[model samples]
Target: MPTQAHINMPAEPVRQTGMLRPALTVFVGLSIVTGLLYPGVVTGIARTLFPHQAAGSLIVQNGRTIGSELIGQPFSDPKYFWGRLSATAPMPYYGAASVGSNLGPANPALTDAAKARIDALRAADPDNQAPVPVDLVTASGSGLDPQISPAAARYQAARVARVRGLPVERVESLIAANTEAPALGVLGEPGVNVLKLNLALDAAK
Candidate 1:
């Protein structure tokens, strides 16, 4: 038998095409164009088209900015129309911390919270026995909801009237004026924009 010697072949060196450099370039280009430029253009157009809304729909009083229509506010006094109960942490109407209570109907905590809100409402105006509006007792999906249900608005009418020393009928009229109907008559329930209504109240003075 002849002895055969095994010869090892040299391995080929892998080549680097430098494709990653171009891939990164494409990524940066697309990110700037699609993310930054597109958003800036759209926002500019929106502001130009809808000045009031694009500018935060803020309510101003006597040259001072009071609040925005996009956020709720706590109005515990009898003089003001109360907005929805807020689930914001640390304080009510905390826009920076907008969130719902996440309390299910079966949750005892939810029940107790709702009861507390109802008690407060009743204490503010004992004469009005109308059923409490759901919005009044429940925190909205967004803790910063800025509108109040029409029923809630009506619930607070008597208290507002008494505090402002105005006739109930007159206050009701104001509420009516501030009430916004469903969009195109089919989108959502009729609601009273609290910031606008409060601005109207200020203007009345």
Candidate 2:
């Protein structure tokens, strides 16, 4: 019943060999180059050239790890110098979840948050009449900034000194000592590292 031309055609055999070998070779070669060799070489170079930074720049005291010098911690206590307000939720200064409020100047949320910070600062030191630094009232973009503007540090010096029963001059001195200059002497504003200043206070005590 079938035509002779149709019946005469036979099924072509499935060819699996020729293409597979080269495909596997390419996959293995690329995997080795991208997954193993590249990471190993880069890690080796970083560890050799920058040992301390590669190890995370952690601060250890009395054989116990405190924290990293690179990340900020929440310090709401009046005695400790506070760092930038983090947008992280459930916890502040969570490096794993760095964020920003992303609120514009015209946003009511931003205004309210700034007011809250200002009120908190005022409540902490009612007697001192110095104007609150803008840095103190607003969160930095990263929300994990370890440093505050020198003015912000000076603004809180009085309350910290009072609460700790130390002279304000001493607290200011600690702030001055812990202050860091802009990177490469020109990249950013000079900032006072809050954690270092607070730790120096503890050491002084």
Taken over the whole model, the C-alpha lDDT of each candidate is 0.86, 0.86
- Reference-based lDDT, residue 77, model 2: 89
In the range 1-205, model 1's lDDT, one tens digit per residue, is 9899999865433223466668889999999999999999989998999989999888776799988877878888778888888899989889788889999999999999899999998998898888998888999987888899888888898888888888888888889998888989999999998867776776674
Specify the poorest-scoring 10-residue window by lDDT in model 2: 6-15
What lDDT tens digits, residue by residue, belong to model 2 across residues 94-171? 888788889999999999988998888888889978988888877778778888999999989889999999998999
Work out the TM-score per prediction.
0.87, 0.84
Give the root-mean-square deviation of each candidate in angstroms. 3.5, 3.4
Clashing pairs in 2: none
